[model samples]
Target: MDTGGGMNEHWQGVAEGLRDDTALLLAVQAEYRRLYERCFRDDPAVNHRLPVITHAFRRLGRWRVFLLLTPWMLARLLVPDEPPDIEIPADWRPAARRGAPYTMIGPAFSLELLTGRQKAHLNYSTAIGHYFLHPLVLAMAPFPTPEAVFGAWNDVIAARNANLEKMRRQNPQQEEISRREFFSGGFRK
Candidate 1:
């Protein structure tokens, strides 16, 4: 349980986790930037929401909690992490215990996405990464504008992807796929 003294520290850890999870950062930021530019940029109150989101993100474990949804088989996160142990943010309001007439509404932020009219869509993996993990990273980072988020993560992902793509082809064992002699389908040589 968080006693408030470590709230900032808890979020800082989450921030670090996000930075280290390169695949997660890469997948989430691409889609997030597209959506922000297409959908939310026009909203007059977006600037105001940044702080609320930042605050909410720190509470939401800087998205480390949500990053667990990464596909175990395919994603193969480079910096895999056990979920960070952290308290839920204070802002989550629960329904009244058993008998209250009126319960306080929780903090609600309305986000619009995938409006059902678009042909292009986010895949399952990217969807999870975007909706669950992207916000917290955006919140915790020092981006002064929503668009800034794209450039920051974009450069990192591009560099890392380029490096990883090279790594896939170059085997350190110096092995090669050579022609086999007796392994033909039904014909032995």
Candidate 2:
């Protein structure tokens, strides 16, 4: 089925749901920020060589600074001089470029969108969700509302759940096939 309108409708539904669950959203967002900060700091050096380490450190340092400054910047805009709702841990630092640590920023952001309390701060979430649902919104010039923007998001979730069910149904059969192959010495090459 054509999911264009449905995708946008899903986005709206998710956004509305988040707005209704503001407290939970805030808590989740706060947790995400902390996780991101931790990843940035705990990243290991990609190479122990001094030159590579230096280069990676420089890049990571700049990224770390930007990440560190984000909360302060948001605080200034949202509540001047007030402490940020989320606290950056003492150990928080940027990940080295060489190590390229897998920061869970994407999932954290998704969680924020899933649980955000304020619609005004949803620009980031909307943008990210829009990208994910790009297929549905590609033909539309500008999505009418944030809800419409999330239509693709809902489609993705439905698709994922369906896939999981299909996998579960096929897994037993696949396991049996594997066992038969093993017993038959099918690996002889």
Measured over all alpha carbons after superposition, the RMSD of each candidate to the real structure, in angstroms, is: 18.4, 20.9
TM-score, one value per model:
0.24, 0.23
Instruction: Give the candidate number with the greatest lDDT.
Output: 1
Best-performing candidate as measured by TM-score: 1
The TM-score between candidate 1 and the true structure equals: 0.24
Clashing pairs in 1: none
User: For model 1, what is the error of residue 153's alpha carbon versus the real structure, in angstroms, after optimal superposition?
Assistant: 1.3
lDDT of 2 by residue, 5-80 (tens): 4223322112223323333234335543553465433433211111100000111211110011121111100111
| Superposition-based RMSD of candidate 2 using all C-alpha atoms, in angstroms | 20.9
Off by over 4 Å in 1: 1-141, 172-189
Residues 1-189 of candidate 1: C-alpha lDDT, one tens digit per residue: 121234323221222324544544554555345445655567553443332112111222232322211111001111113222233233221112212221112222232322221111111221222112222132323556434544555687799998987876686442332323224433443
